[model samples]
Target: MATDTDFIHRVGDLAPALRSGGQRLHRPLLLLWALAQAVNGKPRQQPWSAIRASVTPLLATYAAAPGDQAAVYPFWALRNSNLWEVEGSEELSLTSDGRRPTLSVLNERDPLAGLLAEDHDLLRREPSVAARTASSVLLRFFPDVMVDLARDLDLTTLLAGGIDGALRPRVGEPYANRTAIAAVYGGNGVGGITPLADGILSVYSDDKGPYDDRRVAGMDWIAYTGDGLAGDQKMSGGNRSMSTYRAEQRPLRYWHKPHGGVFTFETWVVIVQCRQRWGVGQNREPRREYVWILAPVPSPLRATWPEEVKEALAQDVADDLKVHDDLDVDLPPVALGDPQGAMTDMERYRKLSAAARRTAAGRTDRSKLTKVERYVRSTAARQAVILRSGGRCENPTCLGHPTELTDKGDPLLEVDHVHELSRGGGDTPESMIALCPNCHTLKTRGSGRQQLRQALLVRAKALHRSFAGSQGEDEKRREPTTGQPL
Candidate 1:
């Protein structure tokens, strides 16, 4: 429904409204430089020096006099016209008059952020759009001067998509464009481009950039304490209590990278919503859904969670879920929470036997156990250990394969702690062992339990070695044997 005229008017209407000065060529020239950068495949934002270098030649050829031109003036003040936006400016010290900062301040702070990504896309998709915008600026402000300068810079073809039908440096003379863009792709600076085929790994060489490659299963699991380290903000659902902060669409900031010794950078994202889903028996367990909606706001800016609450109805999306987590319910219901009045006859006997495990030592202080303790006993970890063990008891001394599958289609095996919790053992995967009822009873109650424990430890270590050695091996070659009972 939109036409090219709408685009031209949008670009042309951004004339600055300076309080005292007459019309100036700064905004148009800045726009032209930005357009040129887009044509040449440069980043959206150019450094101030790049802007100065790129536009200086044009200004020198068209200025009224020798001392009447400055790049910083337009770069800093163009934001007033809504034609430009700058960040890293708040860090700069402002003058008393509250006017635009001096060139020195701008240079020191280097707040010359680039235009919006959408505008860059517009210029790229329709070179004629930029050409028309430039023509409008010249016709409106400096008809006479622009006439001569336009011709000298080959503006006719440049604005009209040139001989090759693109607004770029002439064919086979790529460096013919602006000096700053030349300096960038020409590989003259530290922030220059590198080819991946060279086998040199650099952050700049990576096409996905830093943030896009790092994916978390759920945003709710991520903690943004405003700290810079991933270890400082560990990813765990148990550690997070989202009840205090109701899930809603809101601004969220996450640590990016180290900017300096004292502070770090952050990427902003919107917490679209907090979602909850129940599996077959997941009602006893809580899990948060992490779905990223295409953000309605701009990127690389800080967004905060809203304190005020608003009600909104939920709508269904058709996209397939990429990842889903369901608690491992194959173990005895005791490992999960006790299901009131639902204990099977076999489970009742197991619970009575487990009660016999109680020594003079008091019951485990469950309240005092950290989330790390809970994670050791988590459904994910339990499933991982069992599946890796291949649906059989892991004791090395005896053969006790699962005779049947649980209701969840998992092998029926008892989960045993390699070291008893009362004996000061932590509930880690390495410390947890899967066993059949016979092996579990023998290891938990029979004589030579310490010897059996030693044998299970050896088998567990062998499994780890097999999994580790799986790298570079064929799938069939890497397949693990069905575990044996102790």
Candidate 2:
């Protein structure tokens, strides 16, 4: 008996015998048909003759090319996907390919075949699972004709919402430390928001940071402060990175710190709303910052998000979450900043470097050039790189990578130099960029180091210019210059 996880795992990862690529939908179509049938109370196992007659015409008309209704293979070969079973299999002779027998022998035998009982039972009990699975399959394989296919399969009720991956987090558990959290949700380990390889952030927060971030005493909402410390936070940088997750339909990996010990992975949260609140600057000047209101959710399956919270947040927007006054000392505003922020970390570094180039000089020692240079050993460039990354690695060609934690217990997104410092590369932001351990390894020691370095240089320059092209220009015209003091 396969468990729910097992059924879900197998169906999602089906390795159909795709040696014949002519009809790509054979196995998936067959599985969808079976799952829909399960929801409709169809018998789990049925005779092959009946199965053939039922699905042949549909496959021919809907899924297959002309005169290519090869329905026999899925019935026999689908067992290879581990979601089906053939009755009286002990007496059957197999083909040389070890997948299925000739269609003629199957016609004579008239064997019973269908979804395994355990799978069928689970599908019947949890129709949403069936719907979610069928919905995913249709979207993945038959997107163009999905609506018609769903109607044909009678999968309307079972598929109320599509199921993607669940937001990965063992909620309500104490993480050994923040580093463990970074390892789970890939990102740079330092900030409240970690950028995933997919260009989104996993926002981490606790009282540990400068901002007054915390959980509402009894509510499942987090009062998160947007990234920035002075001069009225702008809708740029980390704040912009975290705020867009809601519209992107992404879930946030929100981590909370309690006294900075054994960090707890608070929950998977959605950006409910953000409001401008008053805050204090490093120099005790009055400033406004973005405070994001995050509502906890069970998963990324949007259908499961708490509706009441949505209603409350929407209502809160109508009523306006009050701004926190700087003088209050205890109170602050809940700020939600820009869809795109004032400037990215890379931009900030460039501006800082440009401002200081007269006093500061680029490295001129070309005696010991190597493929990659060590970290600049400074926080200004490193912070800018990590903040710009928003926790994800910055390499454009990095299709995906493992989330590793650094010695500082942050996502081990190594702050490595794109150009060799030993060979006169400036130990500067333009010369340095954040990379995941895998990409860092490849850049440092891989055979294609030269090509990778050149590519990385392009990526670094692009990232550096990201903000100036949009927000920097905007900042020059409309916003004030605000960041850590030089």
Candidate 3:
């Protein structure tokens, strides 16, 4: 029979011995052993059922010896039992136990523990474990990793395509692996190991300062071109093919070429068409407008183009100018700034002009305008009526708000007529007003909105008929149908 001293020694040796055996014990068994050692050699016996109830499911078993059997027989319980020890029980009680058994046992045997333990140790050592933990929690609940990555990819592609990096800020460093991971894992950042086989990875070096003269120092550069934007560069998944390239390194500068003209004149123009029908408020007219913009082409032009190509382009521009007096309205000017400079500038100018025009169009206050004055006035007046209607559909049941702002902060409010203009609804403030984009689209597409309206009207008519029928029945029951007060 084991003596009390021997039992104590055995209890002390259990964890180290188990660690040395190199046996991969099930976690539940390990926990039971730890808890058993924690309550070793007490006077009063712990109820087996209570112990089992406390640790069942998590621990495989819970057993204890009675009286002196406690010293000789090895007891078993849960690893969590070390959290408490029983009071008044001279033997072991969990209520008296302070340290949790699993942690304590693991700590004691740490030096001798094998591969599984090493893996746990590695997790503890990771610098990003805390951040990864928080990220894991968010990902677990809301799986939007791929959606976010797609958005990132779009922005990176735009920037790599010579779009303004400042205007299109990049997210975290574009990792080649992340793209493949996203693709294979349903864009949620999990599973799959196949490498992407077909894409181009472009690297962009962000200038540390506004001026190119200042070198990007030791700061870790932001990466924008990788698998995220270009898909898997190594794999051909039949998805969209993507490529990235660095923008022109030169700063924005205008290049001017002298034409045979007495005055050095440059001009820009913008023309926009409202693609959707149903103009401002009740008006169902498509608004079409254009603007003329001018800036002198810079003097002392330098071209990266081959001499022959440059000469050909210059001749082409000259020919076009001779054919059309208003170059701004007739053709897009040759971007003389650098490679792809003209296209980039034109796009930027278009966005800026659109924003300005939208603001001007929405304003209720009258302002001066050179051209398209009548059109602008009409747009503003219609917008004013739409705004006055609480910026929602006039229809009581149409739960649609009128104005919505775009990502770039432009208002996207549309005026919707209560009745279709084609059906003889005259263009008047009373006939039309503001409606949300969704409602306008629904109404235009001949979708369920019209059906829903018809259904509601039908339901209302039926309800009225039912009430009238009930009143007639009541009159018949109360008196002869010859009109008598009940």
Candidate 4:
């Protein structure tokens, strides 16, 4: 008899060890998928189609090679893992040894299956613990591919405490401050729409799209855009209503669409940086708006932001950074002028330099830069870098997939200096670009670092120019301009 903790440990310890001998990951992937669905509030007993809907993508992502048909191997084989069980599965033909079902059999039967009762209970009662434990296990066994796929799939919402994270306040705001912002906008805000009884966003509908169908075109990667291009027709690639929502500074609400079904985001994304954009509304009015970026809310802040989700996301960044930094290559070392220098610690040096300038000017009262002033100076540049990259790693190879989630359940990406900041590059978007940790570390510290930097700068600038031309030349609008944070 396993204790509850013991059971969970065993679940994590599961390896896809079929008697045929080669190590496989399908079991672990299936286990995590089952746990994720449990966290998402699906019923304890799930049909095979439900599992298929989820696991097929995992197979596509984590399979050793493209077009592998091994997804069904786990659907039947996981019964041995003890964390999973199947019901009504007799219709399928078993292997010659009678231990597992053939893939063809699974395809024909498509029977119902689910997590074991006790396993489901544990996951349901302690979703956070289960999510963290499972993620830790996956991270330990399948770090790079699993972590990246989890983010790209938006599967972190299970660990994210579901809708609770969306209800949380933004940085520097009181909890539930959305109510205040809603009041400010009156009927023009997210609250202006009839709230869902459960306050969760619903499915996408065809009525909402210029797209062709309402099929739940399962997303391979979540996409993000910056404030500067939020209104650009070709940039947003969305419909009029989405544009209207941004124009109003509104949090998203699930709504009807013409082609894509009733579409909705997984969470309530708040504005991080706002600016005026051209041709946003029905009348094509220019309006004040902000670009949305997903960032993990800082810790010590209390909101629906889950500690587990933050830890998992942070771990993903760490793992990605490690992969790039640990790449085996012999490259000439770039000398660090001060190996121990801390960027944050250098702020003190900046203040001292400012004080000396004030003294030389015959001014006695030297006020150091305030947090708000620093924020004002950097927000425009940050927004520009994020917008230019189209909310994905600017490394042309990584595509638009997010490698991690923000506290708000948005994509997490780091902004990097395309030109070395220490080498006198200005803190402007032109000098910076957005990158995932792996790509950033490679560009800054890996072999061929200078060539990579030059390449990225070229791509970043070209992307900016292309985005501007597509949006009727909104280039001048993205220039460093500051406004008070909302």
Candidate 5:
């Protein structure tokens, strides 16, 4: 007849070994002990059947001998030393009287409950402890396994494949931001992690993947460490004064790329010369200092030949500069007052300026006709008359719309004479019609004026015929055509 105290200690010692083998007998024993204690005052036998049923399956396969099987009874007895009634037994189906004690309740009453509560509190506070512990154990024992996984995957190829998969199905889809992928992972910090320049880092969402190849360069580690100016005090007998001046001069050059993106092998050479400096004393003379060149290796993994590579690149730039200098020496300056040449250039510029003004004015002019008179001249007024006569353009084949023919909804129509204005054709509505930008360019091309005028006349005649035909079918007679008044 072993005492309950001795049995509890023995069962407690075996608990860890059994748990290591993945057996779960202790929880059910504890639950049964709690239930028995809850019904202590009432005349009721323990619910042995329910407790046995709950825990039997868990221990049955592991208990190989009859002696091992008998260990369950003492285990149940020791755990039930203290228990309390559960408020929600009906939902749990643990008791017919609608009351039962749970292991949670028994633990609260047990003398060692404070230690158990503290352990539970610690586990709750740091849930990641279990996962971190497991990972540490695995890594300590199995370094080779992790290396094999790394070898099986080519990270760059996998990332590119993911990007291609996302874009292939949505061909021709307009990207709102073309630089989004580059901005996220192209060697810049993402979260709180400082971006490392010698390694590759990437992120993969369910729908997209972005990555960057970071390379260590000389410029990344360089720093400016010297100061140029210092303050000094001078004493002459009892009189003292302070003066500030620069000393031990050295030219400083700070190198930076205009666009921060991946730099290739040939792109890292930058040359700078100090143009000007201030803060030197009045007596001290200013002079141009040394020219500086900065070059960085594009890849961290490769060794750099900094001196040789920088010299080669600088010589190439010097050669290009020499070629430009030689060309400037041979060109002659234009003589002043070359009226014939000046007039030719002015005429060319005037035509270009006129075209530019027409484009700027658009299709409409709503400026007070006063402003129109000031800026809109002979060719523009002629164009306006043509737009008003045709509504759009008389050319049936023309695609120009009334709204498309104006700047700010003011008409941009330009008139073309059926016969040249210089050759006796009057500037009247009948002789001119509207033309859009495309047609106007065609009419003004070399030797095409006569053909363009004929084309416009044909379109105008067709339009008139259509209008006349529609009017003839109506019951009321139409108004007569008003020819231009002299």
Candidate 6:
């Protein structure tokens, strides 16, 4: 039950108290951009990922205050106005104040937000109203940049009382081959990369092509090799397109040619991570290349993804946070210490562990492990341990949260098992402990694995006891004190 008039009223009154201090264009800019989307007949529900990549730069450009500008602030705050609607609010765990989702949660979870659907529809139908709302934003917040903004967004169409009817580019259905794909999508169709529809794509094949794309087993994402056959890969060209921070982000498309069949659109993707590592180029010379870690664009709400895929995606996302420790994320929960939730999560991991063992039953050795998404371990168990670790390495030798923290202001730690799960260890909190990536690798694959394991076993036992004692204290504090007023 929304109308263009209601939205116009709300839009005009956005953050009025804050506006009195200085003209802040963050929310107004978002509104204008959304209005433009409506004028062009785009979908009402815009993904946060898309909005981040699109509006963040604009916020940096237009905001009056240096410290208060961020796409996340406006995108999350606008819902209070009732003009904007978010698709994934319930799933958000929120902050300690029970206010907003954390930056990490907002970044990792692909929540959809934009103008209310009814308002979007009405705005699209009545261009004059849309134009009026936009004019008000210009007159109030960013009058100086109205002409520049108009040029950038091509707002002339809307201001002239018309819809541009801009069509979103799509990857349609399967193509006969790379050739067939290029014919329609307009790429060279020779290598892994295809430039089409304002996005970059990567193809995976067994053939010895220029790009040696590999989807490792038990992993949902692909380590997409950067373009160029020789030397270290640079952060230019198609490689830039895959990086979210480099001002080259675009919609990521996953095009697969399975069993050497016709090329098919797999799913839309967003880069979970990107890393440069030592490798051999196509010509077999020593080189390093950027590996763009691509995960499926998560659903706006609850994921309908395959179980294995979802599991691996969860692991990759955690890995992504670890790798980019300093990257800023918005707000959500690793802190409430919800024991019941942790218990349920741990039980789910137990099943995943057994399933993983069954899937790899016939594999001769670890080296021969098939490139199918099956893992004999649980990311949930790992995460539970990480939660228990409180962000610092659990090793007694390194017992404090690191100086460096993940964007969400949490410590980066890896869950390590005191006894190997593969060697018949239980999948419970006591069996696993969290450590920093350094200690984890040293314990699992280093020379003194036995010594580290023994030390971790002792430390983990003490850690759990401490956690239990702390929980009891917290409960006692929450309960009424003896002889207190009831």
Query: lDDT tens digits, residues 182-244, model 6?
Result: 665454577665444212344434322455466643355666667667887776766654553
| Candidates ranked, most accurate by lDDT first | 2, 6, 4, 1, 5, 3
Best model number under lDDT: 2
TM-score ranking of the models: 2, 6, 4, 1, 3, 5
Q: Residue 423, candidate 3: how far off, in angstroms? A: 5.8
Model 6 TM-score is: 0.33
TM-scores of the candidates are 0.30, 0.40, 0.18, 0.32, 0.18, 0.33
Off by over 4 Å in 1: 1-7, 16-22, 65-69, 151-156, 160-486
Backbone collision count in every prediction?
Answer: 3, 22, 23, 22, 18, 8
- Cα lDDT tens digits, model 1, 1-486, are 334444443554564443333446666667666666776577888777677666677665564312323776677776665546777767766667777677677667666666666677777677666675555455344544554655654465555542222212111232222233324222112221111111111111111121111222212222112111122222233113221112222232222232222111123344323222111222323222222222212331122222211111022111122222221322333333234367643343233222222211243544311221232224333443564456677776655554455544446776666766545553434446778877888887889888888777666646544543432134235334554321
Off by over 4 Å in 2: 17-23, 61-69, 96-98, 160-486
Q: Given candidate 1, what's the lDDT at residue 283?
A: 32
Give the worst 10-residue stretch by lDDT in candidate 1.
195-204
Give the true-structure RMSD of model 2: 20.6
Q: Residues 1-486, candidate 3: write the lDDT tens digits.
A: 322222222222222113332322233233222223222322222433333333333222112112321211122321222312223223332224542223233223321211122222322343232122222221211122312322322222212322212210122323333344334212222211111111111112222211111111111111111122211123122111111001101111111112231211111101111011111111221222111111111211122323432342344345442211111221121212222343443333233223323433333422211122223223332433333433334434555554455332324446544455344332333334455576567656745767744443333223222323453234235433442111
Model 2, 1-486: lDDT tens digits are: 556545655765654343354436778888988987888988888888888887887787666633423887778778877889999987888778766777777888989888888889888887655665675566445645766787888876655443333222446666676677555544456666655322235676665556667554234467777887667787778876665554333566676776647677667777766656455554445477777767788864455677765664455456454332322221221111212256434445454444323222443432111110111113345545665566678887785563565332455587776876444444445556789978898998999998998888767756755734554344335322352111
RMSD of each: 21.2, 20.6, 31.1, 23.8, 32.4, 23.3
Query: What lDDT does the true structure give each of the candidates?
Result: 0.43, 0.61, 0.27, 0.45, 0.29, 0.56
Best-fitting candidate, measured by TM-score? 2
Candidate 4: tens digits of C-alpha lDDT, residues 189-269: 232133222122111222322211111112211122222322333323232324433332234432233232322222333
